[model samples]
Target: MMSALVLYVTDDCSLCDQALELMAAAGAPDFQSVFIDDVPALQTTYGWRVPVVHDGHRGRELDWPFDVAALRAFLQPG
Candidate 1:
């Protein structure tokens, strides 16, 4: 299986928490959470936009507030 990492980018955001729950429910794959505040570039690039899933190998990114179908599609075999 391809190794992908979901990046939950946010800073003290309740929405991020909700997104985490949503991802959990959607059976989202194992990932490394990256807080926007931790990185200047991320904070600048995704200001106010939290909960993103990123493909470590492909360098692709998917925004949050996604459904199971979206997650499934993102996690599909490539």
Candidate 2:
């Protein structure tokens, strides 16, 4: 299975929660969801860009709102 990382960058963002839920439903066994508000550097870099999903292994990122297919592709190995 491929490893995936998701950065849900948002402070009190509903969209971020939605993204997490989506990932859970998509068979993402293990994924990291980092909130932008929690990290200073992430806040500075992606202040308003919430619900961003990052594939650490692949070094790829996908910002929401993303469809199921797009998300699956991002999570999978190329």
Candidate 3:
């Protein structure tokens, strides 16, 4: 099994919903959704950039506005 990707998101964020949809469409690997609103550090780091997809092991990130193709590329091993 592939490692789980971390999806940083906030409540009431339409973009986050869209990002989830895109990830599903792209057949992305397992992932965990992290709500950043409660964590000060996470809020500061990803407040303006919600819907961020991160590969923990690889330390890579894919921000919003990504399509299926870009998502596929981002999920690739470095």
Candidate 4:
């Protein structure tokens, strides 16, 4: 099953692309990719913050400019 981790992103975004690479490099666990462009509420909530990492289970969010270490910490069980 996919974890509660969600990566909010939009199309044609370079930073989102970079975030994907960071996710891979960090060996992040299975996560959901939410296309904010496709969802109005999501678009409104994440229009300019397309690269946010959200932990649904914990109701936490990690915004952009996160390194591998931060990613790891975010993924840790609370």
TM-score top scorer: 3
Off by over 4 Å in 2: 1-4
lDDT of 2: 0.74
Taking the tens digit of each residue's C-alpha lDDT, what string does model 3 give over 1-78? Answer: 545699999999999999999989988888988999999999999999888999888888888878899999888777
Residues 1-78 of candidate 4: C-alpha lDDT, one tens digit per residue: 777989999899999999989999889988988888878888889998879999988999999989889998888886
* Stretches of candidate 1 exceeding 4 Å from the true structure: 1-3
Model 3: clashing residue pairs?
none
**Candidate 1, 19: how far from true, in Å?**
1.5
lDDT of each: 0.73, 0.74, 0.90, 0.89
Q: Compared with the true structure, what per-residue lDDT tens digits does model 2 show for residues 46-70? A: 7777788877777777887886677
Candidate 1 residue lDDT tens string, 1-78 = 544675656767877787777678777777777787878888788766677888887787778677767877886758
The full ranking of all candidates by TM-score, starting with the best, is: 3, 4, 2, 1
lDDT of 4: 0.89
Task: State model 3's lDDT.
Answer: 0.90
How many clashes in each structure?
A: 0, 0, 0, 0
